[model samples]
Target chain A: MNWNGIAAIWRFEMARFFRSIIQSIVSPVLSTSLYFVVFGAAIGSRIPEVEGVSYGAFIVPGLIMLTVLQQAIQNAGFGIYFPKFIGTIFEVLSAPLSAFEIVIGYVGAAAVKALLIGCIILGTSFFFVDITIQHPVWMIAFLLLTSISFALLGFILGIWARNFEQLNLVPLLVVTPLVFLGGSFYSITMLPPIWQTISMFNPVLYLVSGFRWSFFGMADVPVAASLAAILLFTALCLGVVWWMFRTGYRLKS
Target chain B: MSAIVQVNGLNKTYDGGFEALKNVSLDIREGEILALLGPNGAGKTTLISTICGITQPTSGAITVGGHDVIDDWRAARKLIGLVPQEINLEPFELVANTVRFSRGLFDRQRNDAFVDQVLKDLSLFEKKDNRIAELSGGMKRRVLIAKALAHEPRVLFLDEPTAGVDVELRRDMWALVERLRADGVTIILTTHYIEEAEAIADRVGVIRGGELLLVEDKARLMSRLGQKELRIELRDGVEALPDALAGFDLTLSDDKRSLLYTYKTGEERTGITRLLSAIQDAGLTLADLQTRESSLEDIFVGLVHTEEGEPS
Candidate 1:
């Protein structure tokens, strides 16, 4: 329903994405390339391999997940937050649009932006390291679902944040740190048994493990478990989004 | 003319228990400009917001074109366009794209011709390709109006459309409003500028402290509450009031050079004849005499001030 409205919002967001080509599309590609250079060069020399995979290749999914998760959230969070900040959100609120359609437009475009960055990083990783995909379909599936889920999370953050500081609080303070600690650079097996148990509690660990499995066919957790984690988290994010719209939490006011 | 938008017993109390509206009711006839005049904090914006579905009412109901604003919001909203008080446009978006995007949001089919016309009408066609950040303040306000009109709605709400614009743009906006009226669009605008209401509004509603004191035809309200003043300049200064004029309700100027007589215009007997006769009988020589009618501004100030329990 209201496909025109949805498309208008989506297209407007995408246009904005392209307009800021350096910040939106190029920065992630360049920064993640630096991650490859720093992590692959400095760390790969000593620890040549982990689980029979090169240290350089092993970190590819971790890097992709790290960037994808943060970008998805940041892109969407800023997407909605800026409009609300400058008061342009009233245009969308007064339009003949449902909450679901609004979410789809902003989150959908944000997820797509994150996916573009993820795919670019994947392409750029081939230059620094040797890599293979044992399950290309699963890689794509995980890429899509993870992008959408994190984008939804970002959408919620956008609405909940009242100021600019709060907008970046979660992605910078919470998500980036979790990505680093969630096995982005090294395997969890190298950790002490107690730390490994605790690391499993980190949601980002499941995403990286599952994504890594799709490439190397070796993972820290069962593929089914990772899939279940993503699905469950997605459901939770969806529930929150639905509740936000239903109550008009920060939007209606 | 049939009622295009009807609001009945509408009430809005904010989360902190501040009541912004109280049992407000109104019927907007098709193709008439209704001006809601009120001072700041008078709930004018709240009333417009509730009808546009931007703010939910705590109680009561509203319908636009016979569609309930709540249950059939999509249908109701399609017929309404709002130019809000705030001028908030995407700074980076192109001007033309802004209007097109708004049309698309209304589910309107592609109509470049219509968008083009709206831009042209708002005198923004030349700046269509420029980003909003580059446009001047007057141009930005025009962009807001163009965006509101892009979908060709049956009813349009302009909330303080000419609040801080230059005289040229204000006149341009007023001309545009008149053009829209000629095209059969029902217009509802809220403003504190009494002159604006007097100039363009077919009907005027005075609102104060979340209460609508009156809604009447502009001409009728002016005549019904309109008062006249008679100023009689004396040939010389007087130290004291004349005993012959003691029967009249009159005030002598501090210098005692003139006398001011206030009377209702609606009364058949304005007492002007008697007052003039009294002045003549008192052997007062009048140097000059003038009669002036009160403006809507006076009536508005009177209404809002009196409602606040203050002397007007």
Candidate 2:
């Protein structure tokens, strides 16, 4: 993709973000704070620290990740969705743009929004908990990887959803439960061995673990393995998107 | 003239077995504006969508500038631009930026000059910096056209370009369309506005029930299918027509102010003199007369209504 084209897309994407400041900034911050209040202050007070970190500090990454994940999915999905909703996708599709150009233009812009919101949540996080980055580079890398990954997943959702309500099903029903069950607030090591095995089955556990490992320098799963799992998931979603473009799936037919 | 677009045996059947276009084939000549006309659900939009590659054809093939629309959409789409009937644009972006970004989508190097020219041509330069939401409905409609023309496509498709536009804006857009045609853009417009087709189309094609009913030059189609109506105004108003005029095929006005005589198309002698003598013999006074040629609207109505009468 041309840098100029990418810049054009990025600029347009940023404009859309600022266009709805209420959704982009206010909603995420308010919702994450509530999660902090409920899951952190209320629930974490009773549970002991799983890995020498304060329960409030331990749950911070999970709350941020929840906002980041949902924001990323919604940004990417809605970036594509509203065009089809109002019938402007025709302009995009009919342009001389290749499938690669479209994916990068749309998915890359979505990742930028996700990353910005993640950073905002991080900055606000310091207000509530005395948080320090154990490995700033690892945290940034995991934040980008997970946001881009979920954004691509959301891009797929945008294409497949034909109606408004149908758009909410996957994120609200499936992804949220997976994020909650994933060891964001407490370590899987703190769970019973049976449920710990089940937690391992949740792909988001690997992402939350991988991201949490960045902040605290420890994770319920091996940090390297978790990193590898997140990378694999990202690659798989990218592959699905590439296949969709090649076959014109849900696009032409 | 070489064919700019060739559609052969195109068939599109939706999932529930509703065929939208059935084995439709045609060659659209280069540099001519072809108007596709039909009633609602007549496959006009489907045909244009298929040609533009917005909707996939279930069977058969399409080529633009000799490039297959499916196999080589890049080249094919580069040659075509479509302005859909709906006023769909990025609600937040400035008009200039939206048009500029559309050009960039084609990976065209920043051609701000071309973008500016399109804006000026569409009379959108004043609204260039305005967000799309700030524009009036007519301005928004013009923005859609400007976006479509940003790349200077060779074959432009306008699907109901003036569906809801006010008369003044519609005429302005029509004038702009004429200017584009003069610049050698081959336009294919689908419209329910039969008057628009009459006023602007070089050739017109009618489609109904998933089938192309006819395609002909504007003048030839009008002359060939065109009927003549002899509407005679009475110099003296009467309650009813004379019994001597019973042999003629006609309709009497309910108010008895006029008599309508239907005649063969383009007939040199309408048998008017004999009819007048008959009226005179019936002791009716002379009346002024007027004649009207069949409008494209009349022929179109005749075409679709006859199909309704056909046995299924």
Candidate 3:
């Protein structure tokens, strides 16, 4: 309810993001560009197009999703964790701000940062391949929702982690593997029937499929399922965060 | 004077069953400076944390300005500010922005003028635009004080405000605390330095083993516990104490060149007159006599040692 408190926290976090502007923006852009070179130029030349779209253009949504998800989690995770690590979290805890405001401030800033990185990658995609969005609104919608949900997950991760190794554990080990195996480079239909069935269960697949559908109007699974999956994940994360603040779990001792 | 903060039977036991605080109760008068003195792991921080609502109490209740800390935390928190033991600030953020942001966190309306004044008060105006990382340890501590004062809360909790600071900075901090007190802010500080409490606190609270042993006016505590020592020098060394001087609590020096007598300053019957008359009657000629009163440090050491020696 304290709008000023929210803005103050939001602004402070965003200022920290801008303090290391190049590192925040360039790392993702450069990695996405490399992906374009290796996957779009090198592989697309021999593999041909998938789903009637060039391999380079078809993977754009997947690449954006991959970058957004990683950045959201990484940025948000480090954001909250650093405060706890250095003990500045007391400033927030002692303030008049509620847990909801604290979340909105931190997660909100992380989502915005991820969204900005996603746009930069989206722009980078234009140089190597001709791409068009079938549904610009849905594309943005999916982009925002995905960024927010992952940022929420990152917030939880930040609180849950006790050390540096634990903080990076989920994103580096679990999320990266799921993204790679979730049809980021090729269509799920290209896989064997059994592998395709397994791929259907990968949560990242629905995120990528729905996002890709917004760009190419084609999806491996029903678009509604993708939307439902994201909504459910968001709700679950919110529920966990609410409980965290309520019980002072990990945050208060 | 009215009490600004009231705690009734506050207790805190960690998850591992370590009781950090036990049946702690206090009343902090408005506009008064109170100091909690304790050694490391004596639960000084825990008591402050519990009152500030950063840590939950296992049992008991605390109210600030008549608002319950548990049920109405938001309102209660708005009335208080805390400068924790840790020196934590966003290293990348500007000092001015840091204070401003801290104020905003309290839901206080934007008052850049007030922020500027706080920086000025703390002599942090020159470093306003500088990043916290660039500031020295002393300056960083000042920034912490500035940040706490940004919201202009009625009560301020400074936990170890002078810990790890140089003597000069510590002096400056004490002066700042005095200034804050002059401005009608109720301040509660925790420290292990007896001199700090003797210098700045109107009242002092002693805690040990998760319990408050005493809370009394600083002047009264010192005077009531103060004991005077009388050192009497003898012209000739004595192989043994004379029977006439046996009525007094006296001890001879190892060299047998002097005798020592200790008596309470507060007691009506100090026994000093009787002891001196006994010494004269014993034909023990006194070459010199010197009297000394105990300091707060002596009393503090005695208090802690006595409690530590007893059964829990």
Q: TM-score of each model's B chain?
A: 0.96, 0.95, 0.92
The candidate 1 chain B region of ten consecutive residues with least summed lDDT is B303-312
Better of 2 and 3 by DockQ: 3
Candidate 3: clashing pairs of residues: none
Q: Which is the leading candidate under DockQ?
A: 3
What does candidate 1's lDDT look like per residue over B1-312, in tens digits? 889999999999999999999999999999999999998999999999999988999999999999999999999999999998998988999998989899999888769899999999999999999999999999999999999999999999999999999999999999999999999999999999999999999999988888888899999998988988889999986777799989889999888899999898999998999989898898889999988999999887866777887655
lDDT of 1 by residue, A133-187 (tens): 9999999999999999999999999999999999999998999999999998888
lDDT by residue for model 2 (B189-238), tens: 99998999999999999999889988899999998878888887777788
Ranked candidates, highest lDDT first: 3, 1, 2
User: For this target, which candidate reaches the highest TM-score against the unseen true structure?
Assistant: 1
lDDT of 3: 0.93
Candidate 1 chain A weakest ten by summed lDDT: A42-51
**Candidate 2 chain B lowest-lDDT run of ten:** B101-110
Q: Write the per-residue lDDT of candidate 3 for residues B194-227, one digit (tens) a residue.
A: 8899999999999988999999999899888988
Query: Every prediction's TM-score for the first chain?
Result: 0.98, 0.95, 0.99
lDDT of 2 by residue, A112-213 (tens): 898999998888878777888898999999999988999999998998889878788899999999998997767888789999999989998988887888
Of candidates 3 and 1, the better by TM-score: 1
Query: CA lDDT of B212 in candidate 1?
Result: 86
Give the clash count for each candidate.
0, 1, 0
Question: In candidate 1, which residue pairs clash?
Answer: none
